[model samples]
Target: MENRLLQILVCPVCKGTLRHDREHQELICPADRLAFPVRDGVPVMLPGEARTLEQAPEQ
Candidate 1:
């Protein structure tokens, strides 16, 4: 994801900053423990589209 976009993108649920998980191509909202998917270089910021952190398998 572009640094400029990353800087401006915030979790829709918590309005908190997100950490980029490059390997998973996801924007991780630590405050909400949700992972927003990034597909084709676009962030899917919708809350309904996000997956809970607990759902992700350990890497």
Candidate 2:
């Protein structure tokens, strides 16, 4: 993902800053517990299209 674009993109639902998960190609909204998918370098920011985050174990 481009740093410039990521810097300006926020969660559609919560209007919160997003954290990019480059490896998984996702933009995560921790406040909303959602993961927005990035496909072919384009972010899918639609709420209906987002996947709910499954809790990850603490490291």
Candidate 3:
């Protein structure tokens, strides 16, 4: 993804900043613990489309 696009992208659930996971091609929302998929160069910001993050693994 382009730097310009990443700057304006935010988590739809928490309205928080997203971290780009280049390897996985997803946008990570820390506060909401969701990973929004970026398919075909477009971000899917819908909550239903997001993947739930396991909290225990990071701790």
TM-score winner? 1
Q: How high a TM-score does candidate 2 get? A: 0.88
lDDT, candidate 3, 1-59, per-residue tens:
99999899889988899999887788899998898888899999999988877732221
Estimate candidate 3's alpha-carbon lDDT, on a 0 to 1 scale.
Answer: 0.85
Query: Candidate 3: which stretches are off by over 4 Å?
Result: 55-59
Residue 15 shift from truth in candidate 2, angstroms = 0.4
Measured against the true structure, the TM-scores of the candidates, in listed sequence, are 0.91, 0.88, 0.86
Clashing pairs in 3: none
Model 2 stretches astray by more than 4 angstroms: 55-59
The candidate scoring highest on lDDT is: 1
Question: Quick one: ranking by TM-score, best first?
Answer: 1, 2, 3
Q: What TM-score, to 2 decimals, does candidate 1 have? A: 0.91
lDDT of 2 by residue, 1-59 (tens): 89999999999999999999877788999999998889899999999988888855222
Backbone N/Cα/C clashes per model: 0, 0, 0
Q: Single out the weakest 10-residue window by summed lDDT for candidate 3.
A: 50-59
lDDT per residue, candidate 1, 6-53, as tens digits?
Answer: 999899998999999999989999999999988899999999989999
In model 1, the Cα lDDT at residue 53 comes to 92
Residue 37 miss distance in model 1 (angstroms) = 0.2
lDDT of 1: 0.90
Task: Supply the TM-score for candidate 3.
Answer: 0.86
